[model samples]
Target: MSHSRRSILGAALGLPAAVAVGTVATATPAAAAAVDATAWTNLELETGITPQPGATPQVRTVTILGTTFLQARGAITCNLAADTKIGTLPAAMTPPTWYVRATSPRNNSQGINACRFEVNTAGSVTIYGATSGNPITWVQFDSVQTIWR
Candidate 1:
C-alpha cells in the first residue's frame, strides 16, 4: 500500500514536469529574449545662466548630445519702481506682435517667464536678456536635456 502511494505521488509530480517542458518547447526565441519597451537611457543637461546682475550682458549657451530632448525655463526681472521693462526675442525680432511685459513687484511672481523647447538636433541654444538703465538683480535662466541613444 505504501509503494502504491509513492508511485501515485511520483506520477503527479511527473505530469507537471512534462507540462512545463512542453511550455518551454513552445516558447519562441523572440519571446524568450523579449525586448523591453520601457527601457531608457541616462540623460543630462549642462546648464548655465549669465550676466549675474550688475555685470556685462553675455550670451549663455547650453550644449546637448545627439538626438536629444531639451527643456528650458527662465525669468527676467526688474524693479518696477525703477522703471525697468523685460522683453523676450526668441530666434528673431520681427513679429506681428512683439511681446514685452513689466516685471511684477510681487515677491513670488516669476517675472517674464519662458517655457521649454524641444531640440532633436545637436547644437547650442542661446538665450538673451538685457536691462536698460539701473542694473537688474537676479535675472537668470536655466535648461536641461535628456538624450536616448
Candidate 2:
C-alpha cells in the first residue's frame, strides 16, 4: 500500500492526522527557451515640464505578477500654475486619482520640497502643491509608489 509522508510520520509518532498521498512523476525539461519579458515602456511628458539636464523627467510602467506599477524618476521643471497638468501616462498604466508627494530642489532650497502631485485615471499628471512664490524648481518621483488600477 502506498502511504503519504504525513501518514507515515503520524503513524511513527502515534498521532492521528489526515494524510494526502500522490504519485511521484519525473519531470521533463522544456524543449524551447523562454522569451524575453522586459516590458518597461517610457512615457511622454507634457509641454510645461522640461526634463533637466542629466536628470530628465521620465515616467515608465511595468507590470509584474498581474499588477501594474507606475514609476517616475529624474528631475523636471514646471513654472505653471497650481494643479497644472504636467503629463499623461499610458491609458493601461494610469491609475485612479491619487495625490502623491514628490521632492523639489528650489521650492524649499534645502531639497525637502514635498510637492503634491495628482495622478488621475485618464493618465493626467498635475502639480497642485506649490504656491506662486514657491514654484517647483525640480520635482523628483523616484521614491513614490504609484499603483495603477
lDDT of 2 by residue, 81-120 (tens): 4557777765455455544334333356434457766676
- What tens digits encode model 1's per-residue C-alpha lDDT throughout 3-121? 23356458657787779788778988776344333222212222333333443222222223222222233433334323222332233212212111212112233354432222222
TM-score, structure 2 vs. true: 0.56
Top-TM-score structure, candidate number: 2
Off by over 4 Å in 2: 1-40, 91-106, 109-112
Give the C-alpha lDDT of model 1: 0.32
> Candidate 1 versus the native: TM-score?
0.19
Q: After superposition, how far is residue 39 of candidate 2 from its true place, in Å?
A: 4.0
Which parts of model 1 are misplaced by more than 4 Å? 1-53, 67-77, 80-85, 88-138, 142-149
lDDT, residue 24, candidate 1: 75
* Superposed Cα deviation of residue 80, candidate 2 (Å): 3.7
TM-scores for all candidates?
Answer: 0.19, 0.56
Error of 2 at 130 (Å): 1.2
